[model samples]
Target: MILLQLLFSFLQVGLLSIGGGYAALPIIQNQVVDLNHWLTAREFGDIVTISQMTPGPIAINAATFVGTKIAGVPGAIVSTLGTVLPSFVIVLFLAWFYYKYRQLKSIKAVLKGLRPAVTALIAASGVSMIIACFWPDGAVSLNNLNIESFILFAGAFIVLRKFKAGPIKVMIACGLVALIISYI
Candidate 1:
């Protein structure tokens, strides 16, 4: 019964989230933190971190993590399946619809419109994650900020933007720096 409920909640997240994986963050945060009480605010930040570091859609990774944390192996499987099932069905439908309507101007226009919205959602997710990382307790006050993270954020942004460094290189460099800093 708990598994069923978890699956249903994830399914709803998968089905309703429109802009993509990043857009799923707010919904996932709400469901897991507010509705389910499965993870605390700090743990939720860890969830976002893990989701970003993982290889797949953020929503699917989050579901798996949350489920595993809550109920172990069976829970992970059920939650992952729940999150992916919606995308799988939607992809099939879109694949058929897209080819059939490939030349439709309205479809093209809609796609163009969605591009900006998706970009905005991705940007918002980045900003939100930055805040969550620097203030795990949801502290909006500047006095409570994590200086190391902010410096890392600024440095990474400059390297990526001005120097045009490859992301993998940047991440590896940042990880090494963080490791060395922690030892000091």
Candidate 2:
């Protein structure tokens, strides 16, 4: 029963979350925080933080974490599958259809239009994550702020933008900085 619930909950999120992991954050928050009461908003934010540090999409990591929290390994497995299944099915169908309609100019035009929309959605997700990092409750006040995180975020942004260093290097540098700061 718990596994089924986990599966369905994630399936709903997976089907509707068009943009990606960050896009799914609000849905996950509602499910885990408001509906099931499985975890608090702070815990969800922590999960998002850990998810960003790992490989793969944020949504999958979130489903695994929340599932494990709810019903252990089995729940994690179910939730992960549920989250991926829709994407698998949709992509397979679209690939086949696109191959069949390869010569259709209208189809190509539609896809071209879709590219920008998808990019926009992904960009929106990034903005959402940035907002979450600074203001988890949607409030931007200096009193309940994390200065270390702000410093790390600003430094990372500058390094990535100016130096054009690869993401792995940036992550490693950020991790080292965080580790050193933690001991201070």
Candidate 3:
């Protein structure tokens, strides 16, 4: 039953979450955290972190993790299958459709309009994660700010933007810095 629930919930996430993994964050959070109460907010955040660090697409990784946490290996398989099924079918259909209608002004306009919506979804997810990182208690207040996290965030942003450092390098540096900070 739990495996079925995981599959069904992630199916909705895969079907409805347009744009990509970043954009799917909110929908996945809503399903697992808000609606189903399978994972707490903190657990969801941890899953997101783990998903990002893993090799696969964030959505698939998240589904696998959530399923495993909720049930077991079978749950992981079901959830992952549910998550990718819609995307696989949709992509195949879109590829053929786009190939056939590549010159259509309506298709072009639709794709153009979707860009802003996708950007908004990604931004919303980012803001939620930022709030979660800065305020672990879920309250937005100066007293609740995590200075270490803020500093790490600022340093990472600067490294990526100013130095054009690769993300893996920045992640490694941040991990080292965090490890040092923990002992200090």
Candidate 4:
């Protein structure tokens, strides 16, 4: 039953989250945190951080991690498949039609329109995740806040905004700062 739920939830996210892995974060968070009670919002955010630090898509990483937490190795396999299947199906179909309709103006126009819709979905997903982070239970309060996280978030934002350093450099600097802060 748990495996089935994991598969269905991930599959739904995989189907709808068209932009990229970050675009899927809110759906995963909603299912894992609010619907299933599989993990807390902080844990979900931790998963996102770890997913970003690691290789592969965030959605797949999340599926494996969350599934394992819920129902072990089999759950991971099922969840991972669920997350990938939609993309596989959609891409396969698109590839088939794209070669034949490559010059069709109507198809081209539809594709152009799709780009903005996908972007909007991605943006909406980001807003939802931000809301989840700040207001887990629909009420915003500083008491529920994680101070270290907010500090790190602020510092990272400032660094990224002011210095214009490459992302890798910023990640490295943040990692070192986190290590130093951990000991203090």
Candidate 5:
């Protein structure tokens, strides 16, 4: 029953999330943070950051980590499989459909409409993560805001976007600076 619950929870995440791993953050948050209470908001934020720093896709990493946290190895396997299964099936189906009807006007229209929605989901996930990082208790806790973290975030954003720095370099630089700050 626990395994079934885990699988069903992540299955919904896989089926509902449209854009990709990052876009699935909100759905995962709703389930893991808001509903099931498997992880705290701060923990969820940390999970996301750790997932980003790691090699694999964020959603799968999140599913595996959360499942492991909940019920050890078997939970991790079930959750990861649940999170990936719908996407795997959908991709296979879409591959066939796209190959067969690559120029269909209806399909083209649907794809075009999906672009903005996916962007919105990704942006919303980013904003929520930022909020979670800034205010661990809740987004309403303005007094707990960390100015230095915001400065670091702004610096990273500028370096990545304006200067067109590579993400790996930016992350390394940020981590080094954070380490230095800890010593000071």
Candidate 6:
């Protein structure tokens, strides 16, 4: 039963997560954190962080992690499969469709129209993560702000944008900094 639930939830995520892994964050959150109660918001945030640090797509990583947490290895397999299937089928069909209609203005317009929506999805996900980081308890007050999290975020952003550091390097640096801070 839990396997079925994992499959179904990830199937929905796979089918509707149209833009990319970042854009799929909110949808995945809805299914796992909000709807199923499979993971808390904090755990979801950690999964997102781990997903970003890892190689594979965020949605697939998240599905595997969430599934394993809920129902072990079998759950991970089912969830990962469910998360990938729709993308595989959709991309296969879309490739054929785009190849056949490569010159059509309508197809071009449709593709162009999707860009903004995808951008918005990514932005929304980023904003939610910011909120979660700043206010883990759901209250928006200065007293509740996570100073260490804010410092890590700011420092990482500066290193990535200004210093032009590689993402992996920035992530590792931040992890080390956070670890040291935690020990202090």
Best by lDDT: 6
What is the Cα-based lDDT of residue 87 in candidate 4?
91
Task: Kindly report which residue stretches of model 2 are placed more than 4 angstroms away from their true locations once superposed.
Answer: 112-184
RMSD of each: 5.0, 4.9, 5.3, 6.9, 5.8, 5.8
Tens-digit per-residue lDDT, 55-78, candidate 1: 888888889899999889999999
lDDT of 4 at 9: 89
lDDT of 2 by residue, 32-54 (tens): 78888888888988998898778
Instruction: Return the clash pairs for model 1, or none.
Output: none
Residue pairs in steric clash, candidate 6?
none
Model 2 alpha-carbon miss at residue 31, Å: 1.4
Model 4 agreement with the true structure over 62-137: per-residue lDDT tens digits: 8999899989999999999999999999899989999889789999898898899999988998777766755656
Model 3 Cα lDDT, one tens digit per residue, 105-184: 99889989989999997899999889988887888999889999999999999989999999999989999999999999
Question: How much lDDT does each candidate structure score?
Answer: 0.88, 0.86, 0.90, 0.85, 0.89, 0.92
Estimate the overall C-alpha local distance difference test score of candidate 2. 0.86
> Model 6 off-target regions past 4 Å?
1-83, 99-102
Those runs of model 1 whose alpha carbons end farther than 4 Å from true positions after fitting are 1-79
User: On residues 85-183, what C-alpha lDDT tens digit does candidate 5 reach at each position?
Assistant: 999998999799988886889988988998999999789999988887666667456678977677788999998999999999998898899889999
Candidate 2, residue 51: CA error in Å? 1.8
Residue 147's lDDT within candidate 3 is: 94
Task: Kindly provide the TM-score of model 5 when superposed on the true structure, using C-alpha atoms.
Answer: 0.58
For model 1, what is the alpha-carbon lDDT of residue 63? 90
What is residue 59's positional error in candidate 3, in angstroms? Answer: 6.9
Among residues 3 or more apart in sequence or in different chains, the pairs in candidate 4 whose N, CA or C atoms overlap within 3 Å are none
- Candidate scoring better on lDDT of 2 and 3: 3
Q: What is the C-alpha lDDT profile of model 6 across 1-184, one tens digit per residue?
A: 9999999999999998977867899999999999999999999999988986688989989999999999999999999999999988989998999899968999889979889998997899999989988887899888889898899999899888898999988988988998998899
TM-score (C-alpha, index-matched) for candidate 6: 0.60
